[model samples]
Target: MQMNGMNIKPVTVILLVLLLVGFYYYYYYYYYLSQYRFNVPPCPTSCSTSEPKDRVPDVIPTDYVFHLKTPDHLQYSQPSIVKGRTDVVAVTPWLAPIVWEGTFNPVLLDSIYKQKKINIAVTVFAVGKYIMFLKNFLETAEKHFFVSFNVHIYVFTDRPKEVPKVNMAPGRQLTVRSVPSSNRWQEISARRMELIQKLIEEQLRKHSDYIFCLDVDSQFHSRWGTESLGGLVAVIHPGYYLDDRGKFPYERRPESRAYVAHGEGDFYYCGGAFGGLLQEVFLLANTCRSNFEEDAKNGIEAAWQEESHLNRYMWINKPSKVLSPEYLWQDFKPRNPEVKTIRFSGVIKNYAAIRPNV
Candidate 1:
């Protein structure tokens, strides 16, 4: 074909038109469809015009009975079984069919035996300055807990070399895992969850149990390990909303698998300090990946960081135990008389103290 003394191939023109059309369709499906896909679910009619259905039964049945037992009475005391085998029992029923068990023995039955070794994992950005606070917190935690309870601190950081070299207690251990740095704290937190999942899969030995994911900036007080083992435990966020009516960092959209819309219930949870059997951590890690992936496609960074995702997961999957705020005391407010110790005291020098400037 000839156009203005220049020859144009008919096939080329057709190909260009088709390419443009394909590009248009791709955007429509990825952008437009994504919006519709993530739209929030409608509020319940009871919440507005009618009463919501009774989620719990008003009358108790004779056959329905609740029994509380000590950790010794439990079926399994290990985190998980080997990946493919089913013979292993879970430390808690919530973490079914334990795949593998960690070496950290439970100190549940006797206070004297309660000093068993425990492994704690932390995800940090450039928390170099905060290292002292963490060390102080751990030191305090050791003094309050059973003297025999050993702690192996696993620090997942972006700048491994920059992490402050601190002296740990005799039973305390520290290991750092490296990650890519990000300016957005929320993005960093979300990616840290992913990094934790990877470490559990690769670095963590099969014999390890009781994995804890903690914020690098937070400190651990005396009440850190008083609770029983083999179950999921979370500290109350001093920032937690008393009622669902109040606006919370909790993710509320239905399109988001992490949505928490029930205004009358307690679904939101703080992620500052959380620990459970190894199998449970694996499950939680898997859930975090799904929620984070969904949020990423929508251009929404991890809502309120990874805590929001954790809150959503805990809501649907009730933890074995719900701990009071004493576990992870954020440094935001003055300490209460009853509070034993503060975790991430905001008084820390600066981000440079613990984290790298980069």
Candidate 2:
């Protein structure tokens, strides 16, 4: 075992060498050997699949959108016109329901939506260091968001290589689209509407029935299932839903296209999460993208970027269903008495570190 001052074991030396050799081959197989077998090309800095030739109209029948003509009794609770949540205002002045827990029966809603066999498409952006949040966002989604539905997740990110490989359920799939990186966070945030509009126009319109655009740095904590489905859905921002319209942080400048005249706005909807029937969301995204571009032409930016534009758009075109603060609660905020559950929430993040610019 010891020769002079040096202790040595032939069996130990042999085992250590074998371990290093095993690791080398393991890495080689996955890193190089696998690629060689498949004849794969190197990924580009910004890569994208070629555009499809055929494009289709973005439309869905309005009739029977909520109800089935010939109904099947799925057997849930009795009708609750007067026996629901009394603490919170359940419906907006425009008659759009503000969805909170206990307001709707999930079983009944899921059953109806299941019958349609509709496809739900979700788009999330993870450019720059925001790619770090994709794993939890996607993993939590598989657990809570539309668990049994036909779902497609379109991830738009500059760092496609960093996109996490989440094993989705049978009816769910993920698509990654590479976008050029940006230096300004405002540019990345504002350009989301443009990218979503193009996504719908180019690909989603053909097979997708609905689409939800969500922020990447968020996770689903509860059911954001078929119950939230509608023609146009907007989540009431958790930060300012309880505040007055004057303090609501709308774009106040008349020069900006996103400007909302004083006393001429509804609920402050979040830009982080919004969606609807394919055509409805297409129209919303298109309008916001155009207005944002027009404002750029005039050399003015809104106070809150795309969020301001979204508020202005929602003023003229009311959201068909408004989700409460429960839908998009902030991780930093304490749970309010009215919020029975947090469905989908933005995770607390250091903006300076993750964002390209703060």
Per TM-score, the best of the predicted structures is 2
lDDT tens per residue, model 2, 204-274 = 86678899999989999999998788888999999998899888999998777788878889989999999
lDDT of 1 by residue, 266-307 (tens): 535667667665555655666677667867787665457678
Distance from true location, Cα of 105 in model 1, Å: 19
Q: Candidate 1: which stretches are off by over 4 Å?
A: 1-147, 226-228, 241-245, 262-267, 336-358
Tell me the spans in candidate 2 whose CA falls farther than 4 Å from its real position. Answer: 1-58, 64-66, 69-71
How much does candidate 2 score in TM-score? 0.83
C-alpha lDDT of residue 60 in model 2: 51
Model 2, position 8, has a per-residue lDDT of 84
Prediction 1 global C-alpha lDDT: 0.53
TM-scores of the models, in the order given: 0.60, 0.83
C-alpha lDDT of residue 152 in model 2: 98
Backbone clash tally for model 2? 0
CA RMSD per model (angstroms) = 16.9, 20.9
